[model samples]
Target: MILITGAAGYIGSITSYHFLKNNYKVIGIDNISTGNARALEVLNKFDNFKFYEGNFGNLELLEQIVTNNKIDFVVHFAANTSVFESTQNPLKYHDNNVSNMINLLKICEKYDINNFIFSSSAATYGEPKTNELITEDTPKNPINPYGLTKLIGEYILNDLSNAKKEFNFIALRYFNVAGASLIAPLGQFSKSSLLIKIAAECAANKRDKMYLYGNDYNTPDGTCVRDYIHVDDLAIAHIEALKYLKNQKTSQAFNVGYSKGTSVKEVIDIMKKISGNDFKVEMADRRTGDPSSLVASNKKITSLTDWKYSNDNLELICKSAYEWELKI
Candidate 1:
């Protein structure tokens, strides 16, 4: 059986559906601090799925679930993901992201869960030194506490793998993850700080106007650039990672992205075009620690696994998200 932490959240819910459709029994857990309970409504339709609405920090609870379900694989996605919020309250990030992982790892060790998949982030790379593609070997110089916490999580995994030769892990450092599940119509329901979600809200008239953080960066449109991958594609990457781990005895990390960059302005334009609503956009001062560009080089994952991105097109991503926003 597979155990998925943060299974009710944006990425986790869709991932749970993918696993269940592929005939894998899944045990899901979430604290509901930031997760949407409605996402679990979709997963509840599957008989192969079971859920616990609690935090992963509870060792006794995790132990009980792992023992009862005989969980052998763990896909950990629970995290405090706001970069700006992490700057304000760093201890929260450390406790939720780093300390929580430490506790989860302990449970994994105790339960002998040999296969693990970590939902890492591109924030671990921090600001890009050059405008080049960020490979897995890129220098990890995180500028924020949130990124630091994820980087520390990777370190803990690496150390544990070296000491316990039986434990194997795959850390997927994801780029900007956006869009809703086109199949299930389960979109991002959390109060997100992401640009695409914000733009979608503005287009839906939930907000009167949207603020562009910075427009003076050194890029084609003088705005920050990021690689936006559809959430379904990311779900596929997780399945591939799990299969790759089952076949190999080594632990590794791979970048999950589209190998292309999309600027903030470009995303706004696409959302506006798709929604056919020209919402008011205002330019604001540059946010501290914002990078000019951060794109991924996904060669490592493609070469090692059968994972090929099927939905890399930006228009379809924006359209799917916009449609979901309208529904919700």
Candidate 2:
């Protein structure tokens, strides 16, 4: 059986559906903290999908699952991802992202279960030295605590591999993972008011417009530029990476995003057009740890897994998110 951590999370939940549709016997684990129980409701319907509602930091619980289920492949999407929040409460991110990963890796060592697929972030790239797309070989100079933790996680995985842990793994450094689970009526069901969610709410009258964090950046649009990839495309990348690792390939990291980025103004304008509600978008000061631009050199993942991004454009991604928000 294949195990997925944080299976009820936006990315995890969608990847779970993808694996199920592909006929993989899937088992999921989550504490249901930031994850959505509503999304889990749909996953629970599948016979192959079993869930253990708990944290991976619980060593004994993870050990039991590894021992009992004979988990062959593990897709880890259970990291603390909020940049602003991580800065406010750094310890929480360290504990969940770093400590939990160590615990899970220990279990993998004991059980001799090695294949792993990790959900990483573009934050690891930090404020890029240049506007060039980030490749796997780029120097990692993380600027925030969250990004530092991600870099540390990658190091830990590399260390384990160096010690001949016999584990095969891949870390997909995601840009902005935006979209819903396309398999279901509701796709991405996040608890927090993320950018897309906030925009959708503003359009739907659930909220009064939205906040454009900063505008006087160095970019042409004078706003942050970020590469947003669809969740299903990311899920497919994970599956391909899993398949490649099963062939006994070495552990590696790849930038998982389109080689392009969209400005903040672009996103807001698109939301306004789609929702037909011009936002009284107030231009506010820059939020903490946010860089002006970050896009991926998606070459590694594309070459490694014969996979291509289905929708890299911002309009389609925003539209999908808006559509999903309307339903859920």
- Find the candidate with the highest lDDT and give its number: 1
Q: Encode model 1's per-residue lDDT on 1-328: one tens digit a residue.
A: 9999999999999999899989999999999888888998899999999999888988888888987888989999999998889998999999999888899999999878889999998999998787789999999999989889999999999999998999999999999999999777588998899898899889889899998998888999899999999999999999999999999868989999999999999999999999999999998998766678889999999999999888999999998888888889
Q: Candidate 2, residues 62-118: lDDT per residue as tens digits?
A: 978977797999899988888988888999999999998999988888888888888
In candidate 2, stretches whose alpha carbon ends up further than 4 angstroms from where it belongs are none
Per-candidate TM vs. native?
Answer: 0.98, 0.97
Tell me each candidate's RMSD, in Å, in order: 0.8, 1.3
> Whole-model lDDT for model 2 versus the true structure?
0.84
| Backbone clashes in model 1, listed as residue pairs | none
- Error of model 2, residue 15, in angstroms: 0.3
Candidate 1 residues lying further than 4 Å off, grouped into runs, are: none
lDDT of each: 0.91, 0.84
Q: How many residue pairs clash in each candidate?
A: 0, 3
TM-score of 2: 0.97
Please give the lDDT score at residue 62 for candidate 1: 87
